[model samples]
Target: MAWRRDNSAFDFHFFRFFNSASPNNTMSSGLGKNAAGVLNMTIQEVYSSSENWILYFQSGVYFIRNYDYGGDLQIGVDSKTATQPRLLKRNGTLGQQWTLTKAEDGKSWLLTNGLLGKDLFLGLDGAKPVMTADKTKGTVWGIEMNESAGLPAAGNDLITSVQNLESPPVSSSSSSSSPTASQSATPANSQTAPPTTTNTGLLTSPTSSSANGITSSVEQPSQSLSAGGFEFDWGCCGVGFAGSGAGGKD
Candidate 1:
């Protein structure tokens, strides 16, 4: 089978590959590294900033590159029988080249590795990213541009852009936990505890006020600290704290 370039389907821009089966999960280069120090590929909720990929089309196949580390490594399988994909050094091999075809659903694309005449496709095995001949598996993928990363070098006008895929709704827990102006004005001595690590290994610092829905993971100081020569009366949600000098302490 002759490999044909599908230029209209994808562009030479950075993108995030989201699995239609798991909307929240995207293609990630896991923390695990091989002897070459290259990261392994997995499908999971993005915890850090290294998940973006760039689909660079050349000759007839697309070279799927991990944005942050694409300069040295590209996505490829270890061997013809290997199931898991990894970020390997670009060796100009067919195993690193992938052909993307639009799935029947019309919203997702199927990534096929036509290495050694085997029509293995990139899919998810539970949370792991695997390659298999079964198309019925979680092989359909929806791709969206990494808008924050910006566009590619201008001048390549032949590249066609894919429609923006609907992103999963953001949860309240994903909201920014940065300190507010008032919180920043707190005395230097009144130090907030560092964010605690969750079971999933994500660090979160929350500070919330019951009066409002705003919440944060930042731990407030338990001991009362005076602000502006006035004793502060702390309350739940770290709000409604009154000072004795300005008003009667709660």
Candidate 2:
């Protein structure tokens, strides 16, 4: 079976693809190591901050992206002589699209780029840090989930604030039917009104009042903005793998 983008919730899950040749080493973009510009894919021991990636599903293919740096894994040519895997910005190009087929081992996946050629498979070249797609030298990768990569749900702070606002503390002071000396002296139309609450059930600001020598203030909760969804921001520095490899266009 082949893997294609489905736009499902599973697409957000972070994963690490371990090279079958070296189970302890996985693909890394080297973002945590301060690599910049176009980066060649390198292998490293699983590091949630750098090794975890999101197979962003879109259209009919997957755009493999670094979980932290957000750069898409792509194929680039070097002087028209060598083709290598690179980490670059997502441009929706054919070079950035990939498909995954389950290997015969039943536990590993064979990654291929149809645009490059159906025969070319993504794999490391011996012990080098570069990724190659030679027909005879492709890698089978073991996919595993990184549970710690999950992020907090969007708008959670807003929900909790609304819940607390729904039940305001009941006023403990009792009301008296008879009017006081000061109340009788003041004209009914000239008396001040109580503070107004907004439609969101939050006070505009803190307020205090004094009546018959007694003073009290309404407690207010800190305001928070609601977030519609999570957004990943990529910096100028690209996350490269552990080993140094050939450079390509950014």
Candidate 3:
């Protein structure tokens, strides 16, 4: 699959504003504008240049985010959970240290010990496992690897680690019950979903957004902070960077 993205998939129906910042403050608030305000940011898939890179998220390769819970992986069904992160650490256990294993299809991938359910997602194609806020109990979540960016420098390596870790602007919960922890940060489904803001809103979604660029469509809004909103920096520039195109907060 080739890299194709539209900045108009993010939904702001339940969106609400919690705070309002000025050019002087430059600080973000976790509050929302509506009952369920969404965060403001862009989307860039990870792709590879040499062979198949990790930047291509749709290809099933990515640098694990939030490496604390159970995101580690090894090979085989009998594999056990390891101790550290794979890409960043050196002696991280096998469960924590894994490399992408692309099947003959060149699309589906199998994680070390990941079972989609009781048996793990088998021959899982298109959708790749990624680390996100939902990993409060584990170390990863579902994500499209190749679709983000990075090319040639995809996963399990530093090159593909491009701003992959840089989260967009969002509110953080100071309490142990931080709402951002359980948040999905992406959209859930298509049916009954709100309109996409990526190309639709023209970069005014986040209220912090301007009208000079494009943004990534949020697939899930897995967060709730006193009804306030949160935003993380989904790194992207040039072709699809953050600017006025986003439906940012006003």
Candidate 4:
């Protein structure tokens, strides 16, 4: 779980220091009487160091509390009425628990009640926030982390800071996209084989002599030769030759 690394004792001291430094409710002013107003008031409270609803995300579990409001504002359900959420004390009840579901846009999130099948949203008719079955823009909220919350500026920065001390160091093999052993060992030109050699077979024939059908062996000069898959032609070897096989020999 990603969390504050400070010892429990130190955490307690830190919380006390910040809580004491926070401003009181009397400091907030010029706010309306609705959820928007509450958000503005909370933001003002944060600037003034006043204790507001402190939202925490730990090990995927979410908790929102405003100690100044006498305890955590739990989602309490009235038995008689339809399941309408109201603020109550924190007693580790399921109804008080919530999970933050991020929206299609990364900036906003929907806070869903753990026990009741309802989402926290700003009711149009009332100044207080409530829970409903339907999700809407009113239900979406954005949370910003501050240094007072014991978190670094960036989420990745937080992960990097604790990476070495809290968790095992990430191996270079796992972090890098280096070439594999086989890929590095193979030569690029290995796919090309040497040129091939082919022979058309020597051509030989007997020519008939003009005198009484006597036959004579044809003596031809070197003609076409196949080397490296290419044919090379040597013109007639003898200039005055006029025999049947007098052309270039193979």
lDDT of 4: 0.28
How many clashes would you count in candidate 1? 7
| Model 4: per-residue Cα lDDT over 72-185, one tens digit each | 243344353234454443333445445554445543345555455433432212222456554542454433222232211111111111111111234566763211111111
Number of the predicted model whose TM-score against the real structure is largest: 1
Model 3 lDDT at residue 58 = 13
If scored against the real structure, what TM-score would every candidate get?
0.52, 0.50, 0.20, 0.35
- Candidate 4 residues lying further than 4 Å off, grouped into runs, are 1-51, 56-60, 70-86, 118-126, 146-250
Tens-digit lDDT string for candidate 2 (1-250): 1112123222334566666455456666565546542343344543445666666433334556664453323333233324566665445445555666556654456676534644677776763333455534546766665544443122111101100111112345735321111111111111122112111221122212221211222222122211111211122112222222222111
The per-residue C-alpha lDDT of model 3 at residue 59 equals 11
Which residue pairs does candidate 4 place in steric collision? 22-49, 23-49, 23-50, 221-248, 221-249, 222-249, 223-249
Which candidate has the highest lDDT of all?
1
Candidate 3, which ten residues in sequence have the lowest lDDT sum?
A: 44-53
- Measured with C-alpha atoms, the lDDT of residue 73 in candidate 1 is 60
Model 1, residue 12: displacement in angstroms? 3.5
Which 10 residues in a row give candidate 1 its minimum summed lDDT? 241-250
> Candidate 3 lDDT (Cα, whole model)?
0.21
- What is the Cα-based TM-score of model 2? 0.50
Residue 246 CA displacement from its true place in model 3, Å: 14
